[model samples]
Target: MVRSRLYKVTRGTLRLLSRPVRRAQGRGGIVLEPYRGYGSCDEIFLIGRVFRQSRPAPDADRDSLRDLWRDVGRRIARRAVRGAAVTARFGGTEQRVATDRDGYFRIHLKPRAMPDCADPWRAVGLTLDAEPPVEARAEVYVPPAHARFAVVSDIDDTVMHTGVANKLVMLWRLFVEDAESRTAFPGVATLYRALHDGADGEQNPMLYVSRAPWGLYDVLSEFFARHAIPAGPVLFLREWGLSWTHPLPRRAEDHKRILIGNMLALYRDLPFVLIGDSGQHDPEVYAEVVAAHPGRVRAVYIRNVSADAARIAEIERIAAGVTAAGASFVLAPDSVAMAEHAAGLGLIAHDAVATVRAEREAAPPEPATGPLPGVLRPTEVPPTVVIEPEGGRRL
Candidate 1:
């Protein structure tokens, strides 16, 4: 009799907890239930608050906000289910399905139409019933074949430009900054889009390793959508708060290196491409990766966020290490420069090599006099002698 009474109490408690869990899972009237009907389609799970604290009357309260959320989710579902018609320009030329009675939606993309590379693609189009019609979007990038080419990217400056070293600033940038307020680096979207689109829509995969924690996934997803950047599975360092005191549970650089090493081991057969900015320890981290992986790294693209000569030199050294290991290394001022460099290095093909060469040869050049000045003479200099030291010591 005692055991049965205890079991009944436990059951009652579980039932009580389930209500909150279900509500927490989705109280906005649009809940995306997993495994119901999402099969072989690109699925995006949306979860967020639907409460307005500034409303005047009680009737114009949280429930009203919830209704708005449901309406927006449903509208987005309708558009996503009709895929190609909405995202044709962004390379979404396929059909999708919407959840029945639930707030779920699935986009059934053809294998070839899906982004095979790590670059982001316009995965979904959303419209919310706001004063100006709130537009919500989703970005997605499928993993590459063979699981090679892990993508190591910086979180703050490279992606969002939040002063990461400052905890308060980082928090404000992440929490308070809305989609309309954020700005992407010039040409960033184009470069990443090209990479995601790949050569003829087929290329290697990418892994995003960032210093931000998993809590930023939603915001990051929205950011990618706003910027038209591609999305990939992200590995983030744990943040401090409920579990610890420091913002990051471990040293950020060390955490990244450890995760990168583990990933290297996990995808031993594949090569990696490290992307970062000059603001932090990316140089050291990438150097370590190059040393450890040797030929396994395909390239390193370091964004020049700082004009510091020492920092630039360090990045060059890291790039040199990658180059020595039979991979390419590039330091670009912006995404356009990176794209040009990538094309030059054959990492991506802007056009057929023969076609480009032919075009170059056919193009006009400056008319020359019979003999140019000595200073104007074009001479071939050996690569080793290009960066000679003051005393003639080769760099």
Candidate 2:
């Protein structure tokens, strides 16, 4: 309770201090910022935000110091307009919803007509029921009927080199650094592309999930575009509250498990390949999801990011259970290692392994200089070998 109050007061003070800068940005009509959404044919889910602005604009390119400053200012200047009435329309279906306290609105509509999956995204129109009525369109990804499997990957340590275990380091990397300055794990883009284009040439759905807050969405989106990582309709991020007493909605494990569960339910016919790093609670969360759903998970990949003996041992035990429950669990040392295993399971083509290895070998080596004074360095454990079950080529 005390922490929550302190955090709220501190945030309020900061917002008050920035009022002039925000006001300088604009003083105009309402703006509807629609984020990409996804769902199946029977039901559609869409989310967006309402703000007081002339129009929506892309974040500034961060190639220069001035550009970086402008980008940061734009992000901070966004102020949500609460209690706005919004309507979503698609295929003769119209639904009304109101913005929450944070100026965000979510719409759930079951279209009367099934959308053609010839294209993955179907557009939905959005209108704000306000003066000078604002409007926007959202793209919702609906996978083809033939999608063999889906890939859900973590964003922080798994795809990019964000020091998430250390709060200060993570914040510095997220807010202070530009998109071009951020680094993705070597060959991660190649491996993810292979998974996205499955062995049979089916376009599998790739969804990125992260524990990072929504404030970093634009930066992360730019990071993916800069690095050529596979794009998902939406990057599932939490609104990490300012309330210190309840900083996050729930334990990280439960929050992730619930999201994965929702995905499983949304795509009932597709088995999932779950990917994350060992630095956080992903092993436990992915293990729980695998155990609960049994054979619905085709494989589990945990990047070897922790040198802690206890953590490694715990993950190994968890892996044993996940394997016993009919899923392949690999604590991979690098992107090529996971690529090789995916090839063995026929998830990706055997030739893709060479491509991944080449990409990995071509990546620049990390700088030898250590972190600045008092900065914590990341610890990584060696990869552990996994014994595949007999006839484990498919689930």
Candidate 3:
């Protein structure tokens, strides 16, 4: 009877201790679950938990428990959260939402067809609610035009291609891949070089706007140096904040637009070039730029990376608008084509303008093309060799 009582006490004590762990598991599960959020928009939250066996002594298993907890924490802190897939539809197509720990994600919606007017934006959020229940739903609303573009650019598949790989996969490749393993599109360097070189007092200074995070600055710099490409002042969007436990609320495109607007305000009269790839929101962003700064944009050049029909149509519309404005809108299959188009615009030329120094210090004129005057010519042909032949005997 005494032994049986002891057994009950032990059982109660074990349950009491296990309760905290269980609660932590439940709360921690939700803490790290990935979800989507908007800065000034609706916030989507996800929750997650860590699971483990409850047989070992709590103190004895402290190390293992701590390690497991840490592992899970690291995963969550690193923004690795598994949840329902969410896709945003804009420009008649869909784009996926990328998630990170703290149950936060930045959903990139297709920009409204008419950014100037309020149009309904749409997105489908999918979630699996097991430990952290997965939920799926569609979100539709118009986002405020928080900023305007002075410039926008394409990221992957435009600047660099780890080929057929996703952004996360490409990031891994960047770390593991060899120097030669990476590739830059043809003429990209030259295009950037021309822009960096600026427009000979007629063109505005260049701004490099891309979706690549600032962390890749060193790697990108190395890439440029390796290719002998000219470097320009780069403006990168910080992916997330150090204090951010969740994904930052700003969309990559939105971030770029914000930056563009800031630049425009600083140099109100300066024009800008919108360089981007077809793989993403370049068309939409460039279109927005055209709309915002009708005459301020110099050109929009899109590097074709995908063959999406809808994207193509959007590009056509953007091109037409650009053409109407006397500016250029080009869609090229590769960087070579982009270069050729730029060259056609007289943006890139071979003729060097004669500078003041060159004109002032040109070599002295070459000897006269025609015969010189008698006074100027040597006096060798004396006055008709008057019988100077054999001397002797005065004639």
Tell me, by TM-score, which candidate is best: 2
Kindly report the root-mean-square deviation of model 3 from the true structure over all alpha carbons. 25.8
Candidate 3 residue-wise lDDT, 300-362, digit = tens: 777665555566666665566555664667676555544554555555442212221232244
Per residue, candidate 1 scores C-alpha lDDT tens digits across 1-395 of 97985554444333321221222111233222211111112332221112111112234233343444433333223211111111111235433343322122334344334444343333444433334333344444434453324455665667555655445645545544544445555566656655544555544444565566443555565677887766655656653221213333343434788867865665566567677766677767887877887777766777666655666666665555556666666665556555665566545568533333443345343122112222211243212111111122222
lDDT of 2 at 312: 75
- TM-score, structure 2 vs. true: 0.83
Alpha carbon lDDT of each predicted model = 0.47, 0.74, 0.45
**Candidate 1 segments whose C-alpha is farther than 4 A from its true place:** 1-150, 165-168, 242-253, 351-395
Question: Clash pairs of candidate 1?
Answer: 119-196, 120-230, 120-231, 144-205, 149-271, 240-247
Model 3 reaches what TM-score against the true structure? 0.45
Best by lDDT: 2
**TM-score rank order:** 2, 1, 3
Among residues 3 or more apart in sequence or in different chains, the pairs in candidate 2 whose N, CA or C atoms overlap within 3 Å are none
lDDT minimum window of 10 residues, candidate 1? 80-89
